[model samples]
Target: MARIELLQVADAVAREKGIERELVLEAMEQAITHAGKRKYGQEHDIRTDIDRETGEIKLMRYLEVAEEIENEATQIPISEAQERNPAAQVGDYLADPLPPIDFGRIAAQTAKQVIVQKVREAERARQYEEYKDRVQEIANGLVKRTEYGGLTVDLGRAEAVIRREDLLPRESFRNGDRVRAYIYDVRREPRGPQIFMSRTHPNFMSKLFAQEVPEIYDSIIEIDAVARDPGSRAKIAVHSNDSSIDPVGACVGMRGSRVQAVVGELQGEKIDIIQWSPDPAAFIVNALAPAEVTKVVLDEESKRIEVVVPDEQLSLAIGRRGQNVRLASNLTGWDIDILTEAEESERRQEEFHSRSEMFMEALDVDDVIAHLLVTEGFSTVDEVAYAPIDELAAIEGFEEELASELATRAAAHVEATNRALNERRLELGVSDEVAAIEGLDPAILVALGENEIKTLDDLGDLAGDELIEILGDLAPSIEEANAVIMMARAHWFGDEEPVDGAEADEAAEAAAEEHERANV
Candidate 1:
């Protein structure tokens, strides 16, 4: 009768907590196991089991039968084990049934704690399993409490947090207020499964639109990208699979009803819906809405775009505090430089004159020849110095001999520039450790010396992005920067001598020649 009552209690607890009946029974067994250990010696290997069907409790002391008894409390020799069970043998478990423990007040409290702790662990595991796959999903929760500027939300069976920074600017919630946010992360922490919710995340706006717009929900329209200045303004780029339907119009809905619904949820944040385009330039133009673009020059190598707008539209294109261009850059993943038509024209003429001067000074050429070289897209002395004789000769008014002379002057000028830089580098007291790094040229070494980075350790201490920022135009790509930093750091591992940059090059060339000779 008592065993049946115990089974009914387990079922009731499981149904109340929305957990499995077997888990509740297991918790009960664990609690009883602790009580058994407290009653018996703590050194004894104690265990407890509760039958799932009948909830009959069984407490036992586990002893491992061994040829020699090493542990008197938990291990017994086979002869001693055979007295209790005649068929017992070495390397066998000898489970001795223990008398049912009548819990005192202290023991009962300890048992209750064990059961509660086990139930809490099972609950946390259940929450983590349920929410881990739901990351990036929108969840509706009620604000339960606020702690240190962050809100704790009750998500039905589980709880979530909206950190203060993750909340939109100036947004506040009462204890019982309902909130909708994006589930950005779920982590299994030592205390419990933590569900991190965010209202400031850019995707939260897209999810709100997804909830309100049937076209987006049905997959006829897709949200390509989203950028937000939460509680102030946002931009969303959308594309439509069906050419007949306009994605922006569909998101805006009848008389702005759909977008207004999302805006209300975001606390009056303004939204700009733009059509996504395959061309980055076209997409950037669309992203900067309400301001006309006169022209867009893209530098694909650097992922930067220069936009020329009318002088009157400059303020509009840049927005108040440069918000429009900033959001546009974020949405299109391009660094945007906004310039008025007059400003762009002035910059263009200045660049043209600068390049012409560089060609005339480096190649010892006349103005017309320099202008022609600049027009032919030879921007630097190095470009002219390395160009093939045929390429330079192909320029109008340049014969083979003239092209060869121009290349020679360009090479001489570059060599002179390097020699001056190397002299300056030595005068700055730059160490050979920094100079020996593979990609650190004389000019870059001078720059590093001017910045007080005179040692290899100083260079190696910098992150790749930090090195790029320090070197400016002299910086290598991020991959190359990391490689150079690693090369500088290689000496820290052992007594191996650092390779000089020029010596390393000669060694590589020699290896290549040896390979060719071996093949021959």
Candidate 2:
């Protein structure tokens, strides 16, 4: 209320809010200046200065010298300046201090409102400094409340928002529940600091592992890479500094107690701990664990791997709904394709039989059936899989219902063809062997999706572990695989021509010449 008391109020508020006293004084000056401008029309430049030392207030009015003083608010005449300072030149600009006008009632109210607004602005700036750098750091929050699919969390110092997409899939927090989140982003807005958080970040998993594993926390074990499908599964690749220290074992903990602790925080999502390997092939195999990979062909250019697992383990390698493979892809930074043993055979068979496979044995028209199916028509085995019953009925001399029956019977045969085609694709290098296999049927091949297999060259590149994954479902005979390789070796690399009499004599002469040179 009084001049002396303004200093005491400024000092006390500054100390309480941790703002500089000069800043408070500057704010007081600006606020009073604003209120004065509103009350006394600020058409001219107005300055209000507060002496922090004495708590005295002074207001000055400034006007530009103009030939004609059009508005009284902004211009002072040459005669007015000479009256105040007798030596003043006609062109000299002058400022006049307005005498202290008491803020009897209304001005006091305006000053109080101004002071309140300035204090709020200073407080906001102070809070922003306290929270801005916390971006990307982890923080714990209690679920304060929820509205419109978003969460408000109290992080002790400030509140943070956790968006629905930022949440772990299938995991929900109730009001008052404590949750940890990765600080994904933070922004200083006009209202306040907006701290964004996420429980779905892959780094959150890495941080959790570091917290749970003493070795990792201590730097004795380092997590090399991590892949995650938040709220479902994750794969982490870890390494140890000492050969004796088992990095994977340490991360897993005794009976998986350590990982379980982390998992509990994450609402039961599964984590697979794997030993990081320098060899990409070995790492890929390890990544697709629980499904034995038979071979892995690396495409370093694409950062992709064509992996082959046994004919039975396909589903397991790819995982339930492809989550396992998906996480592995993220962790490894690799594009992975899984192929089975039968698929390899079916691929090669289609390639080799592209022409000859259409011609039938002993029947000319039935042969036409194969020709039309492959040459002029359906490219996919699925097309033949669901080919119209009437088409088969139209085959020369084919009858009613007999045609449908033929379609029904051909259904099985079509599946066999597709399966055989798939089997051919997988034949190390020979699709022909898949075609020649006596029991092969195109319809059966189609059903088994065998025709989709393209080439053995394609199969040869796959990681064996990928094919081994197929064992979970289509368990093809391993012995048959070995036999196919043997046949392939015999057919392609084996004797292409009989040894002639002249060649035998030339071989004997060469051996004699070699023996004479050795003896010499």
Candidate 3:
């Protein structure tokens, strides 16, 4: 081809594929190199280079100067190489210029295939680089086609896919129709860069709100969290940096204009715009809106909450098919349990009676004393046993003598319970080493023994979730569980000393990575 024609072809291919012209030129050089190898001998070290400015092509063959020539085609003796260039060293490569290749029918076709493959690879790389960082942003595109219940969108620079499940329920798009979707995922696969889009993602709603609400886009108000049922209902938690601005009102707009814009695009999905609070209890209360909450009890350790509402508000609070509570749970990152007022009252009374009876039996006290103990926030015998003498004596109708007697009884009761648990653990064949693990009390040791996790190695072999399951309600939080397991595992390493929670997790992760490397 002519020099001008070479540059024109490269420029045209680059423009058409939206790739760099230099990449296209490099592919052309590679194609020509393959042709040169075919024309001469494949065994020879053939290469081709093209001048970027003038588009001049050069074909050459390289032979390495070696002390001894192993391959006659690609290597030459240092003595023979010295004749061509006296300064040539043993590792130096000498290039010999060759005539341009004459393109036969077969050679032309092979060159075209090579160039096309290289150009396509470059194009895919370009698309991946262009769209990878755009993930989580909204993309506007035209529907190019529909195949197997999914839409192939032409995004101008790249193509994207919205699977049927990712589209709003019952929403359909025909060819050439404009569609807006969230760029949820972008991945480089063998075929090309696959850009996955979605309309049902929680962040899709969040990004739509950002586009519609100027305050959110400006960072004056922020979308703290979002939960969606997709096409049916969604909830968004908004927070304002400025005290003067109401986040809910800003998101709702005047007469619900801002949120309605988003709802229309979402196939009329109902939206609940709630103001976010740093306090989890207050946040959860706001999350279950339109239905009044009578009380909220939080178990911070378990990341769970119990919401009590009026009997008539039960259905509303739970929503249809438990959607309201489900969305609230997702939004606040807490497990929510809903109960009617009557149910909560009955449960509370049952707990009070249970605690009173335990106190009466454990401390050898009367109903009045047990009731006072329960009222004074003494649920566990350990709390009474270890509590300050002054604190117990300060309770109304209780003197120092009575407080001392109660504390003595509580301590004896706790000691007896621990002794029984320890005896049971021993009977179950639980090792003393396992019992000595930090955070493993006698009750936990008995529980582990019951599950046949009787040895230190047995406890160490357990994953966090497995240990949690075996212990049931007596199980610790995941972090604490992992720490206990690691402490139990310390003897496996050179250490019998205990490690803290953070150090334990780090050690576990390092061990896991080491195991993975060994397997690989």
Candidate 4:
């Protein structure tokens, strides 16, 4: 009866804790071992084992057979060990059966505590193993409690937390309310496995759409990107594999039924399903809908775009407090600057006038000639100096002789500017070593000298953005800037000088394109 009851108790604990039967037996063994150690002697090598089929418990003291007894408690001389067993050998453990122990009140309590602690540790391990692989999955649970920091949710077999910040703005829950969230992360902590859930995660919205729209689940439509403002609004870019199916329309569903279901789940947050495009400009234009874009000026190297909208549509384009443009920027992974048509036109005129003035001063030409040069897309003296004679003569109303004269004047102006800048650079103690650096012209060298960066090491110490800031208008793209900095630091690494500016620029541009493709 005692043996049957022991097995029955172990089975009950295993079933209640949802742990393996072997784990319970192991916990029981450890508990018995602790009790035996307390009753016998703490210094003795006490061990306990239970019969798997019979539920029989055994207690023993193991003594290591040695040439000489080092400690009376755990080691025995081989001669004496052999007397007990004729085959006793050195390094072998000889077991002595210990008599069954009488369970005192204190011993029983101590054993129970040990078994409970071990069982709890096993349960925590099981929980962590089960949930760790479930990250990024949507989970449904009951709101067990609400507190100042967050809500504790009772998942069927485990508990999870939805931090205050992870909850959508103005959303609330009471006890026993059903809640669904994205399990963003699972971490094993000392107390237990911590499953962190979020209601406002961008993926949460994406997953909701995936559930509500069968086309998304079947891979007929793909979600390219998502940006959310939680309770206010969101933008999701979708692409369709089949040309016959419209990605945006499929996501919007028949009469907006699918999207409305998602909106209801998200507490009535507005959603925009935009068709994604291979062209970034087109995608960005699609992202900022309901506000027509008059023009788009993209700077690929900087991953920035200037968007021009009608003056009346400015408020709608930017949204209330800039939310629309901000969400669009987040979705497209680009910095966006919104401008009204009037502002863009004014800026363009200012640039044209500035370039014309520069040409008039540099080439010693009249405003009419300067205007013609600017209109012909000649912004710098270097461009005119190095341009092919055919290109210059091809401009309207320009002859070959006039083109040659203009090229000659442009070259002379560039030469004179370089000479003056070099003189100023020398006066500021700029080193010739800096001039030898590829991608750096005389003007940049002079700028560096003025800023107290006069040595190779000084230049090498600058980050790409810092160098770009110092170069101002002459700054190269980020990749090119980094290449230049690496060239300056070549000596530190015992490496040869890097490729010249044009080759380095080409390499950097190629690398940037490859990286962009990988990301896409």
Against the true structure, whose lDDT is highest? 3
Off by over 4 Å in 2: 3-24, 63-117, 170-176, 214-221, 240-245, 254-257, 348-520
| Alpha-carbon deviation at 121 in model 3, angstroms | 1.3
For candidate 2, which ten residues in a row score worst on lDDT?
484-493
User: If both were scored by lDDT, which would come out higher, candidate 3 or candidate 4?
Assistant: 3
lDDT of 1 by residue, 246-341 (tens): 999999999999999999999999999999999999999999998999999999867999999999999999999999999999999999999999
Better of 1 and 4 by lDDT: 4
- How high is the CA lDDT of each candidate model? 0.88, 0.70, 0.92, 0.90
lDDT of 2 by residue, 1-520 (tens): 5888989999988888777787788788887787667666778677798887788888877776656678778777767766776766645667778766567578778887788788767866776687677765788989999887779999875788999988887767789999898887878898877888888888888888888898998999999998888888888999999899999899989998999998998888888999899998888889988789887889785588998888889999999999888887887888999999778668746753663253332122365555654554444444544767776556565566655654555466666666766665455233554445433344322322342432332232222233334332343333333332232223222355323233533433343354456558
Q: What lDDT tens digits, residue by residue, belong to model 4 across residues 6-114?
A: 8898999999988999999999899999999999989999999899899998999999999877799999999999999999899999999999788899999999999
Find the 10 residues in a row with the least total lDDT in model 3. 510-519
In candidate 2, how many Å is residue 178 off? 3.5
By TM-score, the best candidate is 4
Deviation of model 2 at 100, angstroms: 4.9
Prediction-by-prediction clash tally:
0, 83, 0, 0
RMSD of each: 7.0, 21.3, 3.5, 5.4
Query: What TM-score should be assigned to candidate 4?
Result: 0.94
Stretches off by above 4 angstroms in model 4 are 495-520
